[model samples]
Target: MRFSMHSTLFDPDALPFRRALIAGIACVAAVVAGAMLADQPYLIFAGLAGLVYVGTLTVNCRALAWLVIALQPAALIVPFFPGRPFWWELCALLAWPSLLAYGLVNRRKIEVVAFDRAERWALAALGGYVAVILGTMAYRGVGLRIFGGEQMGGRVYVQQLVLSILPVLMLLAGFSQKQLRMAMITGWLLSLTYIVSELTFARSQDMAPLLYFFELPVDGLNFSTGYDASGVRRFGSLAAVAGAGLSLLWVAAPLRELLGRWLLVTGPLMVALVGLGLGSGYRNVFASAICTLFFLAWVQRFWNPSRVISMVLVGAVMVGGLYFFAKELPLSVQRSVSFFPGIAISPIAKADAATTNSDRVEVLKLAIADSPKYWLFGRGFGMDRFDRLPVDDPNDSVSMLYSQGMFYNGFLGTLLKLGVFGLLCSLLFVWHVSKIALQLGLLVRRRTPSEWSFFDRVCLLLCAQWFAAVLLFYLTNGDVTWWMQSFGLLAGLLMACRRLKQDEGFVVDSDGVPKASVTA
Candidate 1:
């Protein structure tokens, strides 16, 4: 009898067995490879993990999303290989292709929604931003090699630009509100792990392995060694952003309801997470957390008489505590509060804060002074030999000022790299997304507490608050790439929410609450 490939291998009845056999074979191959690379244990384990991850993705493509979100914080801190693409960077590099393949295979099942007016504007702005990047590269004669270069060129800039927007994959993945909420929570918890580990290791002056493996070099300081005069450690990571934003959810009744009796622990948990985040000694994180909480309260309408009075009492008590214990507190805490006028803090904290402020001002001045030359078209991304001059060199300041400006100031940096046009594009992208958020906030306000599900409300609140905080960060501290990622996530959340609301088959009960819907 002639062997039929479809009947013998690809038949639906034989599919499960085939998958099992393939998995077994893969496991055996991994074992053999592990033996061969026993001396390089890290490489062997990484290979084995990759095999398992691929297998899981094949079984359920949705797992890819969970992994992406859950590993997001770790990605910032860990590297797949030394001094190479960070974990998050590698995820971005791999995610799009995997998503595309999944989409192509499941094309018939996937709904292709037309771009709405807001989405169109957002895309236009993004397109303009990309155009500016390319235009600058062409104008400056920079080669587009993304990896393995002593100097950062157009390729590095392009790579960062792509990675920043990769969170948009959440939109294409057709994630439900529940899935998004879970992923956000998972990411938040993972971020807390980082925060706790940092706090635990800081006292001993030993770096956590998670933070030590990559050692993201900023200026001359690594994450673990950066410290203040009072011996308070000061390390920065995107994890601080993620942890603080989600921790603010402790005040939400919807979240409380979802957690049931577990709600009792949320308040203290939030305090711990936020406190540890602040302990990282990044005032930007503290500022972002406060802004997020303010926005959350505003959106959630927590201005009721009792709530307002409670908030006032809490604020007063915090002020009193700080006033009494200012000198006794950790230097990081003192530094964080030093941004507020008349907040009593140690002299060391005050001096540190002033020094930081002075540095930022100098960088801003340099950026503004040089803005005229690259006003229309940017100097382009990457450093030249002159830009990389040693810090000790007397002549390096003026020569490297442009690159320093790009690194330190967000708005001015955009202008230097992509020019005025690119900055406008960036602003436009922010404007459109803010508009969408405003619209969503209005819609949420109109709904009763019962009408909205716990997951949907929390997801919307988290995204909105995080987006607002990122905007604040961009304006003050700079980090265009982080801003881009926040925008992408907010846009994706909005897209998913709109789809859920517009789906024809979705049902609502007499109380206006969604019934048996993905959102519900």
Candidate 2:
């Protein structure tokens, strides 16, 4: 493989045939070498697939961003590696270096957005929180490990932190708003596969064979099915709420534009998505979806007479249908609606809610009592020892402490893990982000619908609603890993939207429908 002095294999402008041939040969060699080294012929296929992926990434750096986005939900369902440092974690770790390499190769000037007062405060608070994390880690003598540890160890904490900050890095690395939107849409679509699988194959027995093919001997893939007191199966997914929010946004305008007058087909599909999400039997997910829909309705100005009548009709039909089938419906579906007035809740649903609420109250009490001890400084990340007791054991204080630290009960978790100082930092972070999101919302509200692109408007609405949901969930059902990453991404999108409005001059005439514009 003789090459010209000016033509290196890694050159972006290298000949296509030469590059492909060299890459193919290298890939084959790697596969053969790996198979020989491992003494496993099956390793060849894995090596080949990995090499191909890497080759594609080298050719298109943006694919790395897409991979990170797609892996959000995938890391939850697919058993890539058993324990810590899952596929998403690995991708996130790679993202920073990949972004840096791309920047170096392209020699593009990195654009820095000026931070406003709120942004500065948010950044400062985030830095303070991180400093506290480090201080605690050092005081506790916890070593930083990037891979393979117990569930709530330092590695997991650091990985979550990395995932949380990834979107900002992507934005700094020059990812465009259109690219992010496409990535999100792709992720949501991919998550639907897992959702559909869960819904269709409710029984573990039926899904066991399929899941087995994806699992390794060391993989601790959880295939447990959740059921309500009435023995009705509940279908939950890692991305259920987020997916539902995105689906609702799509249906609001994007889907309508894509499938004009094809309501018969797309309408049912959207309904199915919303229904599947609500079927998760999680009140938090249901609440988040409702909040998102409400925000969408308000932002889109659905108060027009025609839209009002349509919504009323739809609501009436849905309510009437549910009323008739309430008893026959799955308990999970019934529980989802149990919050509304005039809906009859089954005894099972009521008992289940009561029991769960009681347990949560107990956890909250424990968290409150123990929070004072860690008021000045937190117990530190990865301090929770799951091996102290069985995870399911109610007496497991360590497990409860872990949950509290991860924001299982929202701010209480922050208080427990990061102490009062950390709590303040978190509050500041949320406050500033909320302030920015609100300002953006109000800014968009003042503009005529035609002045702003539909994409930008939708992005703002979605981001705002997502952040609002984070606030709400923080009060109770906080999953820091998922929620923090979502917060970072949405925060980045909010910034991107602001940039489009201010920098790109995105304005369309009344006669011209809004289209997506690429942002630098």
**Which candidate has the top score in TM-score?**
1
Estimate every model's Cα lDDT from 0 to 1. Answer: 0.61, 0.57
Q: What are the candidates' C-alpha RMSDs?
A: 6.4, 7.4
Q: What's each prediction's clash count?
A: 1, 1
> lDDT at 63 for candidate 2?
61
lDDT of 2 by residue, 234-343 (tens): 55663354464556455455332423466566656655656666566666665665566566656555456776676678768877877777767667676666656677
lDDT of candidate 1 over 1-520, digit per residue (tens)? 9978778776757976689788988889877886878578777777778767665552344555556666565425454454455555566666666676766776765456455677668778877877877777667756443455555555456565665445356556666766766776767665545444445455544554555544332331433554543455565543354454555464346542423444457645655556666655667666676677677767766557766686678668766876787778677767777887787788877887787677677667767777787879877665565553334453533434535443466687777667899889988977776766665555465566556666547645755575665567567856554545556555655655555554534453432233443453
Error of 2 at 378 (Å): 1.8
How many angstroms is residue 273 displaced in model 2 relative to the true structure, after the best TM-score fit? Answer: 4.6
TM-score of 2: 0.72
Top model by lDDT, which number?
Answer: 1
